[model samples]
Target: MTANWTTYRELLLPGLTGRRAVESELRRAVRDGRLRPGTRLPSSRDLADQLGVARGTVTSAYTQLIGEGYLVAKRGSGTTVTAACSWPDTFERAPDPAQRWRFDLRPGLPALNAFPRDEWLQAQKVALLALSTDELGYPDPAGFPLLRAELADYLGRVRAVATRPSEVVVVNGAAEGISLMGRVLKAAGHTSVAVEEPSHFGAADMLTSHGLEVRPIPVDDKGIKVDVLSTTDCRAVLVTAAHQFPLGVVLHPERRHALLDWARAHDGVVIEDDYDAEHRYDRPAMGAMQALDPSRVIYQGSASKVLAPALRLGWLVLPPDLRDTIVERKRLDDLGTGTLHQAAFAQLLKTGGYDRHLRRTRQLYRARRDALLDELSRVLPDWTPIGVAAGLHVVVRLPAGVDDLAVQERLARRGVNAPALANYCRLPTFPGLVLGYAALTPDRLRHAVHELLEAL
Candidate 1:
């Protein structure tokens, strides 16, 4: 195991002519197991001579590698690859990983390419500079106060969520917000909750893991069937009322009232996941379900669709009865979400940068959706698009008898990752596909449609 890398020196080493190149090659060799644990590297002088690089170049690379714990150097032992010298192989253009984005029409992303990097950086810089030393420490378990205030104000103004700063809870993402609610519900002796029939599978799993049964009430074009929801003995339900997930239908005004009435009669709670509320195209998204009766509804929204998901920032506007207890759970969960991101976002919201970002992305996403729909119409006229003109994805129902999963598999073989509608359901229902179009261009979407037709 103590073999000197000088052996490969005769092969790959000869091609390395700079410090970075030399470092990268060694890193790759270690990753590929060519330079395994305890494999000594050639001396800097030796490597420099072998690779036609300056001696300092090799020495600096070796020094940096030693610092990174990739190599261990000793006076007499020389530099050798460490036992723990493992890193992701960023150098490799391996097929499996690269194949993830063949067509990449998978849902749950906005126009990530439209993120305002310059504006964000400026806001972050200003916020970080103004942070007092004490402010850098652990944030409040509920959220950074200023961020909560900003979010409360923004939600009230934009989504008509009737919440004050005290009601706001920052979460890593909408996923965590759901998990927190699941814990709260389970602890309150709630044995079951309901979700939309073809709702987010992962959210249901979270509830199930927390010892709650997740009942799925079927939805129609107008939204969740409140009559079915009332029949269920569950005391709580999660709904995507602004624009239903997978289906893309907004809750009809009458249905919304009926759903709220059922909640009141059953003494139940409503978890309104206002996902993709920021990207409405044809018309303004309806005001949040939380506003009509904040006492009965727990509203959740996230920056994932409007901004990048990498930000991992989401908010919950909770009713007073649930706020304190969930805040306690959040304290136990991760102490608190990071303050730096919260403060930076607060600055963005305060300065109107967030609204500016949404405005730009709204236009961009609308165009992308149009492009996708236009292509699909031309290529597959028989397929019908469902849902409102909003969000990052569109669900198109295929003609009767065409198995969506089989079509999905065929598309996979050709490098597309779009999901069949059936994949999100607990009960079998539709034969369709959910295609995310925000990440691709007009031309690329047209091309993807061609590929989809071929797969068909």
Candidate 2:
């Protein structure tokens, strides 16, 4: 028999912060067995509306139970209460909802709901049936050769990147590719790398994590200032030429040419993270920066944004000179990606399923992006939204003197989740919100946006 899942609205309230009135009420709900194991809790959205408190409050309450072993998350399943979790006996300030707000507007994530599960499962079935006993053993350190060959054809058709399979190294993802390149470049006597100011904090963290000096060059409406690049004594620069993260501006043509020219002159390498060029809405897609200077750029692409981050699959089309070093580095890093998963992904790509998925998701994201913008115009007419032409997020610049962190906290009180742009920037800049629309449905997005307006 299937276990009957229970709803603990009352049991959850004693755990809530705002009501001194309901401490006993929540205890009663729990003691009466109203809440049961394997019962999925109401989503932050549903509970927020029910409790008349912010979603953050509900997130905090659930999180408290989860941390105490009251809840467990099963991948491909929902979060559920566990028999082992202990309900707290006393009250404290509501757990910080900032960390748990579910309708997160944070940038650089894809809509996980739209992943083509049926197609991928079908492809996996075919790959499994065709596989031999030998193929089930350890994967090639360079990756499945068929996968690499398919990547070569796919990249060429989509990105205009001219590369042979031999020049490509399959790393776990773009982060791995970047780390590998950092190591390879450092070995070749390049210790200093240049990054755009307000550049990807993740990339900067990676370089800094590897003991590399990252010089930050300012970015303008035209993209990263090449004039600053001319002055830096750096050996490599990581640029998001197709669509910059957070800011969402494409690298300017002049800057692209300048970067290529500079790399040629200084024997530098440009690492291009072209993670989502497939989702462009406002203009024609940009070609790979590596296309202009194949010898000087190491292009990195990933399935995280288009498919799902959990896939942990990405590829690097390196310059011929860096090929062997990058491969050697990847060999040391977990050997390679999962053979079963890679084989399944390869079959999906070869059968055109992946492309169709991207095409469908692209339209879905575009609609969501437009919906977010419409909500922004309605709710934040005075605030300026930057980087609306592409990508999963839109940047909403707050009204002058409006404290972003305070606004974020207030919104937390309203059960909506958004991160301040200040959190993403190293140097102080204008206060804003980086809102991701891909993962949210249209109705939920509108409600979240409404909460954001109420917070402001």
Candidate 3:
């Protein structure tokens, strides 16, 4: 007779075998709450058959578990999890409720669904095959040599970032890179750092958390107000120069020179967060501010937007004087990022695969951005879309007296997740929503925009 059995395929490990493994699996399941109290376990014979083990092994495991108070067995009844046992906390954090949305328009997220998996896998294989025992040992705190070299070349060619391989330090991501820079700046006795007014909220938080005083510098259609920044005594400033966040304005040519001049005159530093500079649609390419003065600027870039955030791979092109300290800081933080992944990324870059992937994805994103704008024009004609020329998201400015947070909450109830502009600002100034388009298809983008309009 066919017996009813719940699948326990995930519990099986290749190295483990026999009754001991079975007992361990059962114990873990009960302790972890995967098998709740009074939950019925499959019969020993059925479990044994499914696991390709002897029924005696399953029976022995069940007997041991029952004796240990994890399970109970009775005549004419099956083995079941016990109710009285307690387990130590594993300390796993709960998942974010915001991630449960059916349609998410949160800004700064790329098209994760379109990641080049097969190409990455092949590159990984090639990297692994080429690695020696020495290469697999402790990694360089700066980064993989090959990746640094390739990145130096690529950055120079693509973004006009002036740097050598030795100046590049591989970081976990832009977030970590910023934190490290903050710490280094604090250690150097810098007390205050100026940040753009409506900049990335996370960037401000990271700076604050690192014990630096955050000074907000207002941004306009021309980007960060350098004239106002010159008036402040902040020793350092963080900026998104290529494509300003939320407002989507490129740093004006005069402002770029003025920022560098301000840094040079005050001996201050510019932490250029080169976020989403690659996804430009309407504008000609802009060279990095670091290229103008590498000594006074810390240029940060990440694979998150172009490739995938899950990779957590980023790079910082530091000035020569700051390189040693930052490398030391990286050594203390996780002893450098994963070696294998770095090697694979280097291989991807070396093979020109990275460039090819970017070309394809950029075209797709441009199309998606166009669809989002077209739909917005039709459905929400009154809402002005800002920063639409580049990046994965656009900022939609609302009419006067419209509460963006209220609209966000209302959209959340309908399974659409969009962030309010006020959340990114220190003071309430702009009333809008930051809507991402790259993650969703054109059809879905149109439908989501329609739904948003209807909800409004």
lDDT, each prediction: 0.85, 0.74, 0.83
In model 3, what are the clashing residue pairs, if there are any?
A: none
Clash totals, every prediction: 0, 3, 0
> What TM-score, over all chains together, does every model reach?
0.79, 0.78, 0.80
C-alpha RMSD values across all candidates? 14.2, 10.6, 14.7
Q: Clashing residue pairs, candidate 1?
A: none
Q: Write the per-residue lDDT of candidate 2 for residues 1-456, one digit (tens) a residue.
A: 132212444445524544222323433444355656555655554666666665444444543344334444443354565554344556322333333454666677788778888998898899888788998987777788888999999999998998998887777888888888777777788878888767666777778778789888777777888888989899789888887767778888989999888888987888888978888887788789888878988889999989988888999998877787777777777777678888898899899998899889878988988888788788779878887377788888888888675566555444455766755565768888778889888887888887886665
Q: Point out the higher-scoring one by lDDT: 1 or 3.
A: 1
For model 1, residues 22-128, the per-residue Cα lDDT tens digits are 87887777788777788777766677776777665666566545545566654456667876655677743333323244577878867777888998999899999
Cα TM-score of candidate 1: 0.79
Per-residue lDDT, model 1, residue 91, is 49
Candidate 3 lDDT, tens digit per residue, 178-261? 999989999999988999989886787788888989999999989999999989889899999998887788889999999999
Q: What is residue 42's positional error in candidate 3, in angstroms?
A: 44
Best model number under lDDT: 1
Model 1 lDDT, full chain set: 0.85
lDDT of 3 at 446: 94
